[model samples]
Target: MKSTVETLSPTRVRLAIEVPFVELEPSLKKAYREIAQQVQIPGFRRGRVPAAVIDQRVGRAAVINEAVQEAIPAQILAAVREHDVKMLGRPELETFPELEDGQPLKFTAEIDVRPEIALPDLSTLEISVDELQIADSEIDEQVKGLQERFATLKTVERPAQDGDYVQIDLAATVDGEEVPGGSATNISHEVGSKQLLPGLDEVLVSMSAGDANTFTSQLVGGDFAGRDADVSVSVRTVKEKQLPALDDEFAQLASEFDTLEELRNDLRERVTRVKKVEQLYAARDKALAELVRIADVPAPEGVVREEVDHRKQAMADQLERIGASLDEYLAAEEKTEEQIDTELAEAATEGVKIQLLLDTLADAEDVQVSDDEFGHEIMHRAQRAGVQPQQYYDQLVRAGNAGAVFGDVRRGKALALVMDRIKITDAAGNELNMDDLRGGSAEHDHDHDH
Candidate 1:
């Protein structure tokens, strides 16, 4: 087989392959034998038919077509290897015939190739990261939030007031016709909490138990939109929240802390950890932005196009999952597909640029993950994802995404090196600790929304 390559673009290539007749002859003979075994002739046994006889009966074109199908993929692979083309996805094949036996098998394949990238100067880049100090008031507020979580709801024999919880049955009608999704039975609603609707909370305040009231409001943003709704609600009971006493016993009951002071200390540490993580993220963002600004390298167009296409497909899939058509989603979001694509193109381009920049930095710095570091990182991610480490590893391997995990680690190490070289300071000009920022706490839910 002989091959030639042409550069279509910086990120695309075309390969022309020519296979000699002798190389394709074996496949042609195999095709003939298979056909003979499947068919019967007048003078020969079913399995004993000759290649010439089978070719005469089944046409040379059919045999050659079968042979071409089997040979094209291997030939393409060989040609790609010979040309030293680093391809991204599968190659598209187009074949043309050269006459019989001693003639060549000719085909052209178009493929996306990985672009050669150059490393940029990283030592000259600078970034500023803010240092945050945990405040006493913030710690107190977090403690109050925890106490609220342990609060009890108590029945009250009085009229329902603002901030009181009320159990009620509600129904709504518009133009004397009952509106869909405007009714609920035995639902507990907090007056002035704004849980149900905007104005409905105000209307529920100051009503006594067993009282029925009616009000009119406009429907908001869903299936009965743009119509006035007349609603009637009857209160069955009124209740108030009774918070737990802020004492040593209360702290012991709420958490592992034995005293209120201990709990407050823990909360203060948690707040510090959270602020540090936020600071680290902010610093990373600033550093990346600076790198992009300083790096003088062109991104591969193929990577940018692939990223844009993947993002569009993801958005389409998300809309489908949410029970909305692409058109409906675009209309609701006030954007057309083209408009979305245009908006995402810049971000996609930047993403490819950043990837190439980081990869180059990793190479320049000789950043690498040791086996221990890789294991630790994988286990840490698995713990955060609530899965076994081996399970997550197996999943990454199966999906062919194991390289992605290593890429993330390498990028992180590269950023750390960049951070070390640059001077990070707060707005007040004090030095900040990157390690403190890196070792921050994860978020925990104190309420359903949190």
Candidate 2:
């Protein structure tokens, strides 16, 4: 087998491959044997038909077609590997010659490929991100949340009010017929939550126990979605909350802390850690955007368009699952269809450009994803997806998506390497460290080279 690559552009290529008779012999023999077992012969028993007899019955061209179909994928893979052509999207078969007797097989494929990108000098690259800020109010909010969780509920003999827990029997009807799955009895709800139905809060206010009222709302989901529903509610009980005072006793009851000051300090630390992680994510994205802006890289038009189409299809599918359409989404978001298209195009172009840049950098730095890293990634994703790790791995392998996962890990490592080399300063003029991403535990070594 022999293969050659033609540079169509920096981001595209044409692969011309030729397979000699010796290389094609195995596939040819297999194709002949498989076809012999399938096609019935007048005299010969099944699976015992000679090649000549099978050829005389089934055209020689049919056998060659079958063999070529079986041969092209392996041949294309070989050609791509031989030339080190990193293809992006699907390969387009440009030409395939009709095989003649004792002749070599020849074919050509055009593919979108990773362009040779010249990344900006990482050491010289500089970007500034927002300074870390954790407000006292944020910590107070966390403390308040904990207090709510430990608050005691008291049965009150009064009308419903905002912030009061109410137990109610509720049902929804459209045109005097009950909506499916829209009725509940003895449902406990916060009066002001408004989580169950819109306009429900307004009816519950000042309504005492045993009070019955009806309010109109538009259903957002189910068979009768978008239809106006008459929701009737009968309050069974109204309960008020007695929050534990923000003191040492409350702190001891709520957490492993003996004092309110210790609990507040812990919450502040947690909030700071969360904010720092957010800062880390923002820095990576901002840095990548800056690199895309400064680097000598051109987004492949074909790849960008393909990405745009894929995103649009995904969006459409998502809306379909929710019983919505593009028009409805547009109206809800107050965006025009053309605006949506523009946004998708912009996002797709940037995504492709960033991917190409990271892939090229990964190659330059010899970035690799180890088996242990891949396994960890699989386990993490499976946990998030609520599936077993082995099941996810098998699904990925079956879908030929294992390479994509490997590529993702390699690209992440490439970005982390860039993070190490680049200069990132906070708004306060202090050098921000990527080490802060791991909860500020700077004593541990990073996963990538410095």
Candidate with the greatest lDDT versus the true structure: 2
| Candidate 1: Cα lDDT at 395 | 91
Note the Cα lDDT for every prediction shown.
0.77, 0.85
The sequence of per-residue lDDT tens digits that candidate 1 reaches over residues 1-450 is: 999999987667899888988899878877777777888999999889987887788777788877877788888889888878877656776545444655788878888776666554555655666658777889879988998899888888877788788999989888888888788999988788777855677677777789898887877645766688888989988899888999999999999999999999988888877887777667766877777776554666767787888888887888878877776667668898888889878878877777667777788778889888778778877887799999999998999988878877777667667767765777677777766666732322100010
Q: Tell how far residue 435 is off in model 2, in angstroms.
A: 2.8
Once fitted onto the true fold, the runs of candidate 2 whose alpha carbons sit more than 4 angstroms away are 1-5, 16-26, 95-107, 300-348, 368-371, 382-398, 440-450
TM-score of 2: 0.83
lDDT of 1: 0.77
Stretch of 10 with least lDDT, candidate 1:
441-450
